[model samples]
Target: MEEWERWERRVQTAAHPVAYRLMRAVAARGPAVRVPRVGVVVSDAGLARQVLTDTEAYTKTGPGAAAALWSPVLGSRVLITLEGAEHAALRRRLGGLFTQGHVAGVCERVLRAPLGGLERRLAAGEEVDLVGVVRDGAAEVIRELVGLPAGGSDFTEAAAVVSSVRLWRRSLTGRQLHRARAALARLSEAAVESYRSGDESTVPGRLRALGLDEAEARGAVGLFLLTGTETLVSFVPRLVALAHDTGRGPDEITDALVEEALRVTSPTPVMLRSAARAGRIGGVRVEAGERVVIVTLLCTGAYGPFSPERDPSETAGLRRLWFGAGPHFCLGMPLAMAETRAVADALRGFPDLAIAGRRPARGVLIPAYARLSLRAAR
Candidate 1:
C-alpha cells in the first residue's frame, strides 16, 4: 500500500477497528451483501445512489434508519430525521443559510483570525497541530451558526454523544439515550434562549423568523452541532496529509484535488437507510425494516487509489457521492467546501508545509487525526 493509504487505514481502524474490518470483508463479497446482523451492505456507487434516491422503497424515517438513531435526542422535526413533504419544507426554509455567498461570508468572518494565526505560526517555522487548528475553526463557525456564546456549549460533549453510536445498532441504548439527550440539552440551551428572543441576528432567531417553531429551531441547532463540526474536523487535516504524502504541494491542491481527496477519504464513511418495503437492490432481495448500510468508503474506493493526475471523468460516476445524493444531499456542502477552501488557501501560502507527526483518534464515529503536527519542511 502507498504511505498515504496506509496512514488513512490507520485512521479508520483506530476509530473503528472491528467495524472497518467487517465493512471491508462485506465489500469483498460483492456489490451488495446481506449480512446476518448488519442487514444489506451496498458497496457499489450506482446501487448506493439508487437506494438513496428511491425514497419510495428506502427512507430515513423507516425502522432502523437515521430517524430511529437520532430523532430521540434531536427531536422528531430535525431535517435529517424527517421525510417526504416535511423534510423538503424544512430544507427549503433553512436553505438560505447555506447559499454560497452566505456560507462564504460565515467562513470569512469566523475563520480569518484562526487561519491567519495558522499562517503566522507556520511562517515562523513553528510546528503546529493542524487538527487542533481545524477543530478550533470549526467550533467557532458552528458557534456562530448555532447562536451560542463563545463558551456556550462544549463541542466535545456533542462529539461524545456521537462516539457512543455503534455501527450495527439501530438505536442508542437506554443509557446511551439518556446521555445523548443530556449532552444535547446542554448544548441547545443558548439556542433555545435565542429562539425565544426572536432576534434574527442569530441562527435560531433566523429559524424563528423562517416560521420554524421553537422545537424545530432547537432540533436544528442540535443537528448542526452534530453534523457541522466533526466532518470538517475529520476531513481538512486528511486533505493536507494526502497532499503532503503524494508530494503535491499546496500549489497543486486545486478544487479537483480537494474533490479527489474527499472521494478517497470518504469523511462520512457510511450512510444508513432502512427498507420501507420489500425491494431488490442490485439483485439482492431486502425485506421491509432491514437496514441498508452504504459503505461509502468502499463504494468510492472501488474507483481506485488517489490520483489527481487522472481525469475528473474517472470520478464523474460518483456525482460527489461522498457528500450524498437525492433530497438528503448534504445541506452543509457549500459551507463545507467554503471551509475547506479557506484552509487550503491559507496552506497554499506555504508550499513547504510538511507533516511532522499525527495520531489517529480512537473510539469515535468519525475517523480523524487527533493530532497532525505540521511544520515548514527543513
Candidate 2:
C-alpha cells in the first residue's frame, strides 16, 4: 500500500479497531452482508445510494435508525431525527442558513484569525499541530453558528456524547442518554438566551426569525455541535497529511483534491438507517426494523486508491456518497466545504509543507489524527 493509504488505515483502525476490521471483512463477503447483530451492511456505492434514496423502505426515523440514537438528545424536531413532511419542511426553513454565500461569509468571519496564525507559524518554520488548530477553528465556527459565547467545553462535550455510541448499538444506554442530554443542555444555554433575545445577528436568533420555536432552535444548536464540529476536526489535518504523503504540493490542493480526500477518508465512515419495511438491498433481504449500516469508506474505496487524476467518471455514480444521498443529504455541505477550502488555502501558502510527526486518535467515533505536526521543509 502507499504510505498515505497505510497511515489512513492506521487512523481508521485506531479509532475503531474491531469495527474497521469487521467492516472490511464484511465487504469482502459481498456488497451486502447481514451479520447477526449489525444488521445488513451495505458496501456498494450504488446499493448504498439505493437504500439512502428509497425513503419508503428505509428511513432515519425507524427503530434502529439515526433518530433512535440522536432524537433523545437533540429532540424529535431536529432535522436528523425527522422524516417525510416534517423533515422536508425543517430542511427548507434551515436551508437559508447554509447557502454558499452565507457559509462562505461565516467561514471567513470565524476562520480568519486562526488560519492567519497557521500561515504565520508555518512561514516562520515552526512546527504546528494541525489537529489542535483544526479543533480550535472548528470550535469557533460551531460556537458562532450556535451563538454561544467565546469559550466553553462545547466541542469536548459534544465529542464525549458521540464517543459513547458504538456501531452495533441502536441507542445510547440510560446513563449515556442522561449524560448526553446534560452535556447538550449545558452547551445550549447561551443559544437559548440568544433565541429569546431574537437579535437576528446570531444564528440562534436567525433560527427564531426562521420560525423555529425555542425547542427547535435549541435542538438545531445541539445538532450543529455534534455534526459540524468533529467532522472538520477529523478531515482538515488528514487532507494536508494525505497531500504531503502522496508527494502532492500546495498547488495541488484544489476542490477536486478536497473531494478526492473526502472520498478516501470518509470522515463519517458509517451511516445508520433502519428498514422501514421489508425490502431488498443489493439482493439481500432486509426485514423491517433491522438496521442498515452503510459503510461509506468501503463503498467509495471500491473505486480505487486516492488519486486526484482519476477520472471524474469513476465516482460519478457515487454522487459524493460520502456526504450522503437524497433528501437526507448533508445540509451543512457548503459550510463543510467552505471550511475545508479555507484550511487547505491557508496551508497552500507553504509550498514546502511537510508532516513532521503524527499520531492517530484511538477509541473515538471519527478516525483522525490525534496530532499531525506540520512544518516547512528546510
Candidate 3:
C-alpha cells in the first residue's frame, strides 16, 4: 500500500474494530445507506451536512443519540435535547462566554503549565507517556474552565465516569446506569459551589448568570466539562503521533499541522441524528424515526489522503461539515484548536520525535491510545 493509504488505515484501525467495519460498510454501500437497527450512515460530506443542520427534519430530540447519551446526565432540558425556541434561547444566553477571545484566555490559563512541562521534557530528550499527560491535562483544563475544584485524583475518576457510561451509550446495563448517575451527582454537587462562588468568567457561573435554576445550571456545566475532557484526551496524543508521521510542525508549518491532524483525527468522528419526519438525504429515502450517522472520518478524507494544509476554497466540503455546520457547530472550537496548537508546538521542539510504542484503545467513546510512549531521537 502507498504511504497515505497506510496512514488512513491506521486512523480507521485506531477508531476500533466496530467503527472501522462500520465505515467500510457504509463506504461500500453508498453515501447514504440504511442498516439493520443501526440507522442511516451519511458517508458523503454534502449529505452529512444536510442531515446535521436540517433541524426541521432531523431533530436532536425524539430517539436521537444526543438525547440517549447526554439526557441521562445533562437532564432533558440542556442544549443537546432542547429544540426550536428553547434551544435557541439557551444558546443565545450562553454564547458570549465562549467567544474566541474568552476561550483563548481559558486555554492560556488552564493549559500553560502542562504545555510548558511537556516542552521542557521533550526538549531535554526525556521519554514521555503522551497518553497519561494529555489525558490528565485535558481533565485538569476542562475542570478549571468550568470552575470546579481540582484534586490529583480528578483525572482518573472523571475518565472512569465518562468511559464506563460511554461504552453503553445506546444500551446500558443496570450497573452502568448506576455508575453514570453517581458520576452525574458528583458533578452537580461540584457545580453548586461553582455557581454560588464563581463569577461570570467560568462556564458554570455564566450558566447561572443566564437565569437557569441551580439544577439546570449544573447540567449545563457538566455538558461543557464533558465536551472538552475526553475528546481532547483523544486528540492531543493522536495529533502528536500524526505530526511525527507527517513531519509538519513548529515553524510556519505548525498551523497546517494542527489543522490537518484535527481533520484526520476528527476527535468526535461520528455525529448521530434521528429523523424527525420522512425525508431524503441526497435523494436516499429516510424514514421519520431512523437515525442518521454522519461518518465525518470518511467525509473529511474523501477528497484524498491527509495533507498538512486545508483547501483554500470557500467551497471546501471537509471544513463545512467536520466541525459540524450551521447553528450547531462545535462550541469549543477555539479551545480545541488552542489545545491542539499547544501540543503540536511542544512536539515541534523535538524535531526527531518518534513514537516508541502505541496501544490503541477499544470499547470506548472516542478512539485513542491506551498508551503512547515517545522518545526523542538523538
Q: Highest lDDT among the candidates is held by which one?
A: 1
Candidate 3 lDDT over residue span 1-378, tens digit each: 654346546655755666677667777888888776777878888888777777888877767567777786678877777778888887787777677787777778877888788777877778888888777677776777667777755345546666665422564557755766677667667678768875776667777877776766877776776677778878777777776566643433366556766676677778888888898987788888878888887887676656766564523546646578766788777777777776676666576677887777766667777788888766
RMSD after CA superposition, every candidate: 1.2, 1.2, 2.5
Off by over 4 Å in 3: 2-8, 152-155, 165-171, 196-203, 249-253, 309-311
lDDT of 1 by residue, 32-119 (tens): 9999888899999999999999988999988878999998999999998988899999999999888999989889999999999998
TM-score against truth, every candidate = 0.97, 0.97, 0.90
Candidate 2 vs. true structure, TM-score: 0.97
The Cα RMSD of model 1 versus the native structure comes to 1.2
lDDT of each: 0.91, 0.89, 0.71
| Off by more than 4 A, model 2 | none
